[model samples]
Each structure stands twice: as C-alpha cells, then as structure tokens.
Target: MVELRETRIQTRQRVQPDDTNNYGSAHGGMVMLWMDEAAAMSAIRFTGEWCVTAHVDGIDFRAPVPSGDTLYLDAYVYDAGRTSCKVRLRAYHEDPKTGSRTETTDSTFVFVAVDDNREPMPVTTLECSSEESEQLRAEAFAAFEE
Candidate 1:
C-alpha cells in the first residue's frame, strides 16, 4: 500500500507574460497542462510506474490568475482501482510577496498506470496516513457525489 500523504505533490509556477492570454490572465489551456502534470506526478509516485491521464472531471475555473502571480498546484491520490488512480488537483494564485492565495481552479483527474509496453498495470491500494489525508479523501468522494 502507498500512503496518500507520501504521494502528495505540489508544484509552483510563476505566471509570465507568455503564460497569459490576451486578457492578461493565465490561459486555461496552460493551467490544465500544469494540472495534468501535477496529477501524473501523484499517480506515478503512488504506483511507481508511468501513468497516463485517463480523464479530468469538472474542471472549474473559479477565478483568474493575473500575470506575475505565482501559481501553486497541489495534487494527491485519493482513491485507487486495479489499474487506475483518482487524483484531486487544485490550483491557487498567490501574491508572491504577500503570500496571500486564492483558489483559481480545481478538478478530479484519473490516471492509469502503464507498463513498459504501455499496457495498463495494477496499482497498490492507497492508504491515508493521517486524519487530514482521510478528510481529503472523503472530500474528494463528496465532490464526485455532487
């Protein structure tokens, strides 16, 4: 078994001019790319195998991240099947100097572990190592219930 906390991944990216859209906010596609990468990292960490994104559900963009803000992405595995891992992904925009953050987007991503031949392979069960990890897993399940 792999502990959920052990697979938790966080990444940061500074939103540069090139990462923005014409509206001067972070581009939706760019944000999705970042989310995918983070989610993949969580899945790979849990399974110890290459993982590919199978689905992204309800990608809600709640706010815009203006250029020059730091984008913080957090991801962790919440559930696992025989060959798939369900990851919860969230992105927040922070003022680099002040350190205030606002959630910009959130989504649930599913990834399938693959072998060297690219065939789906079984993954170990996920275990929550703490109350917080358990709470997060519950919240992820609740989000999908809606």
Candidate 2:
C-alpha cells in the first residue's frame, strides 16, 4: 500500500536564457511541460505503473519566473480512480542569490496508468496516515468534483 505522502514529488530546474521568452520570463509552455512531468512521476509512484498525461486544468500563472530564477515544481496524487490518478501541482521560483521562493503557478492534472501496450490499467488506492491528511484528501476530492 502506497501512502499519499509517498507520492509527493518535487523537482527544480534552473531557468536558463533559452527557457525564457523575449520578455525574460519563463515560457508558459515550459512551465506546463515541467509540471506535467512532475505530476506523472507522482502518479507513477502511486500506481507503480507507467502513467500518461490525460488532462490538465486550472493552470493559474500567478507570477512570472525570471530567466535567472530556479523553477521549482511540486506534485502529489490527491485522489485516484480505478485507472486514473488526480494530481495537484504547484510551481515556485527561487532567487538563487537570495534563496527566497515565491509561488508562480498551480494546477491539477489527471494521469492514467498504462501497461506496456499503452492501454489503461488499474491502480491502487492512496492511503492517508493522519487525520489531517484524511481531511485534506476529502477536500481535494471535493474540489475535483466541482
């Protein structure tokens, strides 16, 4: 049994000059790409199977990540169905010199577990350890229903 906390994932990448747009901010597409990858990893950790990006929504770009910042992505499986996992993702950018981080984006993604043939496969449920986690899990599920 995989605990919900076990599915949590965090990744960081330097925002290089090439990763930015003409405005010197990280490209929206680049951020989304990194979020997708991080979310898939969380889903895979939960299901122990290959996962593919199925859907993404509510991608709010709250702030812009400058070219010299370090982009940080955090993801976790908040809920799951028979074959799909719902992941919550958030992005932050840190000033390398100042070591201060600020949230830049947040979104939700659905990933479907897949077999070797890329066919949808069944997944196990996420287990929550503490009452706080259980409450959070319920809230996350409710948000997804809306």
Candidate 3:
C-alpha cells in the first residue's frame, strides 16, 4: 500500500550550461523535464506499478533560473482515480549559498498506472494518517483551486 506521504517527492538539480538557453537561464523545456521526473517518481511511489504521464496542465513559469543556481523540484499526489493519479509539481530556483528560493514554475500532471503489457491498471486507495501529510495534501489541493 502507498500512503499519501510516500507520494510526496522532493528533488534538486544543478543548472548547467547545457540546461540553459542563450540568455544563460535554464530553458523552459529543461525545467519541465525536471518537473516531469519528479511527478513520475511520486506517481510510481503511490501506485507501486509502472506508470506513464498521460496528461499535464497548468504549467506557469514565473521566473528564470540562471546557470549555477540549484533547481528544486517538489511533487505530491493529491488525488487519484481508479487508474490515474493527479500530481502537483512546483519548481524553485535557489541561491546555493544563501538557500533562498524563488518560485519558477507550477503545474499539474496525471500519470496512469500500467500493467506488464502497458495497459492501465488499478491503483491502491491513498491515505494520510500523519498531520504533515494531511496538511500538505490540503494545501496542494487549495493551490489549484485558486
């Protein structure tokens, strides 16, 4: 069984020259890729099954991340259907020394669990017993409602 807390994933990546655009800022595509990976991990953790990204929405890029900054990605599964999990993904650009972060992007991704033959599979019901997970779940849901 996968609890709601286990579906919450946090990860980071260093912005290298290869990941940046002509302006020396991280390309939108690269940032989207990082968000996708983070959401994929959360979905796989929640379903314990092979999963693929079926849809994405609400991609809003608020800031640019210059090369040498750290890209912080956080994702969590806030809702699910019989076979699909909805994930909230957020990205931030961080100052390596100061640890201050600036919001860069926000989006939602839906991943569908798959069987051995790549057919959609049922997902276990998600639950959250701890206060932290519950709060995170609530805030994630509220963010999209805005």
- Top lDDT hit: 1
Question: What TM-score would candidate 1 get against the native?
Answer: 0.96
lDDT of 1 by residue, 1-146 (tens): 99889989999989999999999989999999999999999999999999999998988889889999989999999999999999999899988999899998878999999999999999999998799889989988897856
Report lDDT (Cα) of residue 34, candidate 2: 90
Estimated TM-score for each candidate: 0.96, 0.91, 0.95
Q: Rank order by lDDT, top first?
A: 1, 3, 2
Lowest lDDT 10-mer window, candidate 3?
137-146
TM-score of model number 2: 0.91
RMSD of 3: 1.1
lDDT of each: 0.93, 0.88, 0.91
Worst 10 residues of 2 by lDDT: 136-145
2-67 in candidate 3: lDDT tens per residue?
678889899999999999999999998999898999999999999999899999987888999999
Model 1: lDDT of residue 37: 94
Candidate 2 lDDT over residue span 1-146, tens digit each: 67888898988989999999999999999999899999999999999999999999888888899998899888888888899989988899888888788988767899999999999999997889978567757766676667
The best candidate by TM-score is 1
Mark the regions of model 1 whose C-alpha exceeds 4 Å error after superposition.
none
